[model samples]
Target: MNEYDIKDTIAALATAYSKSALAVIRMSGSKALQIASKICFYANNENKNIENFEHRKSYYALIKDENNIPIDELIVLSTLAPNTFTSEDTIEFISHGSIIVIDSLMKLIIKNGARSANKGEFTYRAYINGRIGISEAEAIHDLIDSSNKLMAEASIYKMRGRLTREIDKLRENIKNSLMIVYGELDFPEDDTESFSYNKLIEIFIQIKNDIENILSNSKRVESLINGIKVAILGKVNAGKSSIFNMILENERAIVSNIAGTTRDFLSESIYIENIPFYFMDTAGFHKKADNDIELEGIERAKKCAYESDIILAVFDNSCNANDDDINLIEFLNTLNNKNIIYIINKNDEDKKFNYKIESGNIISISTKTKEGRETLMQALKNHTSDSDIYIFNKESYVNNREKSFLEMGLKQIDICIEKSISSFSLDEIAEEMNILNNIIGNVSGKIDAEEVINEIFANFCIGK
Candidate 1:
């Protein structure tokens, strides 16, 4: 068996820690069948040698103690090697649902030399064993952990190999391109073996287009995994805090009409139209000649505006859109490419004559009356898309390492494609493509191939 196979039989209580109608104790490895047979009394199960797990199917049996005192009447499933989740021997005990009961059964399995698994371990093993790729592994975990229907659907699609199919197709394109590049590199002077300069240009251009598509789709992918990061920005007392509080429905920020009420940035994760979002309520921007604390908040607000997934620009409709607000809006105008929504707050006041704004450019709302807040929330949900579906709504990457790897791959491929278009250096292009492939594969630590299957399976819950 490949390294993905756990040499010793492994088992875990696959159900959640809480009470339920049923609990499944799952076991897999070379000795899984032996362990199951010892507790189950069925047709010659103890004396007769069983065929592959599937050939033995589920048998109505009495799960008894070592002394044959019946513990429970249950159904058992045995899936033989090469057909199971790990592509190894596996069996599942459909037993009573109590956590105590599941825990006892798991302890028994360990007593018989079957070790318990860990978080994300099962999906990890599946990837290691070739039952699935890294993408599939990630999807299954996402499917299991999905908090909403959209997330569930996305994860299920990914588990069914949706993202893998797209990525694999991309990989196939790169591979085919690699062959052409290497051929050209090997026969730099031969006309037939090398691609025509025009042909090379066309192929490189096509790959560039495809990579761009990947990056574009990746936007939806990241949105699906990590909901958009929307930074609510404006000067202090522009009702930025009130707007945030109204949207949250529970006062998350201190809202006072007093200027400089909010001296720092505040953030919260909220769901709008089932889309998860990280909403940051920022301090009012402007006046470097101010309280040091408030100024620091102003600086952070600007930083968030630049880096945020979406910029929620607030201007007071109750008063003139101040020059400060104009400056912020104008600066944001430079980022015409960013996803931004103008929230014109405090509509109850007089329509200011001086601060002119295109009404169409913003959602006019009165935070005191809780008006137009729903529109603002809908705006947030409108941009939330399915990323890897299962993993995050948007770039829901858990760590910087994963981010760095993807960034590296993106940059390298981007540069290589740029140069390939100009110089048509097949060697340089092929090198970059290969490096990209390695970076993607290494995202799950699969390149080394010796990481124990248990290490990966341990990442999963026992039931999975």
Candidate 2:
């Protein structure tokens, strides 16, 4: 009786609705084949015999309206239940990519008894029917939304059950530990020796360590999936905008000889070595502001630098180091967590600004001649190549949702460790272990909830 009843047939255009070479429309449900038979006929103008169609075989068919008017010619692939993505009787129509044709075919199919599929309904059905777990579903969404090759690779790894296997292994270890505790509590008189408190502590510690290891690269993974933010910071007329333009390979920022040309920050994203980097060009830093606008811009620039993962501190080589340059260096020194790269711009001119940071990667370049562009790019790539970002061999990376659950499970394990060491109540420890198991179940989709299902699938595009 619900709107999303799994028993009802659903249809949706799986590909982009544009004029292209071809597009695909997917239909799945118990009556998917029956509905296909109603709207589709063989290329020879004979009625489609659903009984004779082989599973997973493509048949050239002509879609027609109820009045027997031709709609479009498409190849329909029919798949029987329990073997398809949705584990239901499914049909996929590979039709020419025309908006009119797609719309007409969809309408004719819907008219013949299939309802429109909601966003991610196909994947949702797969999840509901035990074809894929929640983590795999999330991975599918991430794969679709991935902006870079590394992100896509990571998503594919998770989608292929790497994360699920890891979680399952963890859950098995926890459950085994819980069994020992439960056995001692339920049968204290058995010949089997009781689980030693020290051994229990050791087991919980190992589990805790395992969880911490899993979460170690979560932040870096998040950055890779989103992007690493790089802020360009320097004094006025230090060629910060020029460097920004060079990196973007476009004249995105206004370059001028006059100071304070960039009154605000501009952000753009590009991929370097398959890694996404978001570059921010902020207004130049100055000790003395000409007006409120310049002062606000300076403050904003400082804020941008503080928030960025990496900072490009530019110094003008055409002029002598002044109070503004000194101030910029002092500010950079305050940022202990930032990866600061010192760039001396305007190397084409006579070298007058000689001040340098005590230690850091410094490069002298002339943005006018486009020199040192490759060096700068390599430097950026080097920073991102750190152990956290370049970890391709990692089994899995947890998203925010999974990370939260892992943290909760870790906290619960710590509690179990404490109780096992100090408390005599094995029941109490078992209770905590049970809670940890539930948390793990949430991540692995062994325990399902309607709200969690809705939230996860809501991010997926329609027809996924």
Candidate 3:
């Protein structure tokens, strides 16, 4: 059978197959209840089957093998057609959570008529049956894999059809604009009122602006979903590792007084104020490498600085700023405008270095005395916009798939706007509008729904 086909009964262990109080075996298809009926009998009577089992109700029953032998007592749940997750008859066997028990039950179900579900097949069926859209299917995955409450909340919003509604509204606006354009082209001699050239341009501009806003704010959504990367940068022996350990509250990185101790980037994910942050302890900056390994480490350090969303540039408060420190500051300037915080470490030590760096994003801290740690956290919070947990409260977060379609759509709209400004032919503009319609459809998965569905569900774990 094909991967997306839903004709055959599919079964899978929805819960983890480990020792627990209960494990759920999910089955969905036209023959799901039929298969369940063959294996499940009333707990009080082994010969009695679940032929008259009620829909949307749980039945206390005993799981049986082909010989009518009892295996385990389980709660059998049945949901009838047109109302289940896959919009097909569905059954769930809540058996005792034991590997042997689960394996036996699965074998019995398969023997009766159900096959193992492919990855995300159940959700795929839901999409194909019009029970859920592509975005909602993807949202199910996001909700399952979310690292924090904020990420889960965003996925919940999308699953509840916020994204679908927003995209549908935008597509409707585009279709209306196209209708106006087509009217002007088809009925050239009619005196009926239509949108003027300026009005069309205005509408296009507003749509583009809305798209741009979503894209610009996407970083916040991404950080909330995928955790923010914060890199610690400084010259050799600047106590960067110490600060890293302090932030992570563990000795994850080796702290030493030797220069250039960290020759490779070390990273760990930690939660700060309920927000996830990937704290990276990068190789310290060295002006001149003594070996090839050191040179490679320096390169990795530069790359980390380039990629990090927020940088913690450490400086020794006790020693004079060296050439490497100066070089690090200069290198931070060449980055893609990341938020840089100048941290003066060793504040407990006597002020020996002529610290001359100037910036409001500077804080002095001592890993020895645990000073200025709160301020550093506040700076990180501000840089990553952790204060605004409600960023996804109204607007839907754009996933990478949606982002690609959006960018393409925005580019075409910009082209249409340019053509409109140059007084291009109504037919030519109408052609662009037609292309725009397809692009919008792609964004909402209306044109390539099946392709999007496959790509999205393939990433999901089976039984979900």
Candidate 4:
């Protein structure tokens, strides 16, 4: 038998072990309550038996060691089988958040017949016992590790089985299509319901379109989970660093009037409206670099802009457009599919810049006066808010694994459509449909392999 056998009663510290006001230690198994009863006693009545503790009700209790010596005072909640997270008899101890207290209680519980749970074992049990699907299991992990509000909301939607329901509906549609194909192949003479090739292709096209739509948002979901990278690019003395400081609301980058003062890029992450934005203040662009170091810095700046998701092209408003300014604009134009925001800095100075650019994403700001800061912030929020991942629109949001599976499913769909159009044997198309169904099942964990299930749960933290 495996070391993490589900039959063994398990105990673990559910909360962080740091010295806080309180912590939670949980146990689940057939003998969880029985083991808990051995180490706990009702605080109000020392003569009260733990077996008689009311389910789902908290009772102030006194924990004891092997020799029946008092350990600590805590509140214990008892729950019966088939109604808890793991679908097993469970007990939870809300105790003082002292490492020493937590360690003692864990040891006492083990000594009384409970064993320590392995990493993610609690959630593993929940999945194995059919309490939640694989998508919800992955969502639980994501929810715990989420850094931004958008990620948390997306994870919450997945945890509530939104993605599961969407996949189920898709699966049902595919199954119905397969049934029609089989009926046509089995009884060609029966004229009850004729199967039109155009009708079949239409259904397949709709399913393929649906899958592609969900797959399209995968990158946006990743950006929300991670963070959107924004690069600051401009000519020398264009106030790139100054604008960087204004955005961060800190003197993170050095502000100066001399050209080439910044020889390297500085990066800092900040949360704007609960969305994460990583801003990189790159070295200013120049046609002729004063030295090799400055030239290298300029190269790094161009590379940063190339790799960034958004670019803030800063221009000096106090001076007329020069070769460096025109060159910078041309370079920005060369980039494709980048969210470019033109920033006219030094608006506090006299207006001199008259370079015409045809873009609606332009804002004039003064780093000294802090003007247009709110508008710049609103621009960022607007760009990020366009992502569909933040909204639960009855569309499935997929992770890396699920996205790959769906892509494979889409390929199988294409093959099915091709076979149908070629007037090939319906058997071949049905086989492709079967392959697609299995791929979809893989996404929902309905027919997932044991190794895949283990790998999914392995990413979870211990004690869930």
Model 4 weakest lDDT span, ten residues long: 387-396
Best model number under TM-score:
3
Residue-level error in angstroms, candidate 3, position 24: 1.2
TM-scores, each model vs. reference: 0.77, 0.92, 0.93, 0.91
RMSD of 1: 5.0
Q: List per-candidate RMSD values in Å.
A: 5.0, 2.4, 2.2, 2.6
Q: What is the lDDT of residue 35 in candidate 4?
A: 87
- Which digits, one per residue and each the tens of the lDDT, describe model 3 over residues 375-417? 8988888765434466756667778888888899899999989
Candidate 2 has its poorest 10 consecutive residues by lDDT at: 45-54
Question: Per-residue alpha-carbon lDDT of model 2 for 134-234, expressed as tens digits?
Answer: 89999999899887787898899999888888889889999999888878887878835655888888888989988887777666776776778999999
Against the reference, the lDDT scores of all candidates come to: 0.68, 0.86, 0.84, 0.85
How should the candidates be ordered by TM-score, best one leading?
A: 3, 2, 4, 1
**Tens digits of per-residue lDDT for model 1 on 1-464?**
24333566777777677789887878877888888766667644543423334544887666655555556666788888787777878888888787766766676667766777655555555665789876567667767877766667667766776655655655676677777777777777775644755565566466556555555555556564565688988876788888888878888888776887777789887766666777889878874536678768877887878778888888877676666787776677676457888877878888772565563347889887877877777777766544334334322222233345556666766766677667745666677778767765555444554453344455666556
Global lDDT of model 3 = 0.84
The better-scoring model by lDDT among 1 and 2 is: 2
Model 1 scores a C-alpha lDDT of: 0.68
Output the lDDT of residue 115, model 4: 92
**Selected candidate, larger TM-score, 1 vs 4:** 4
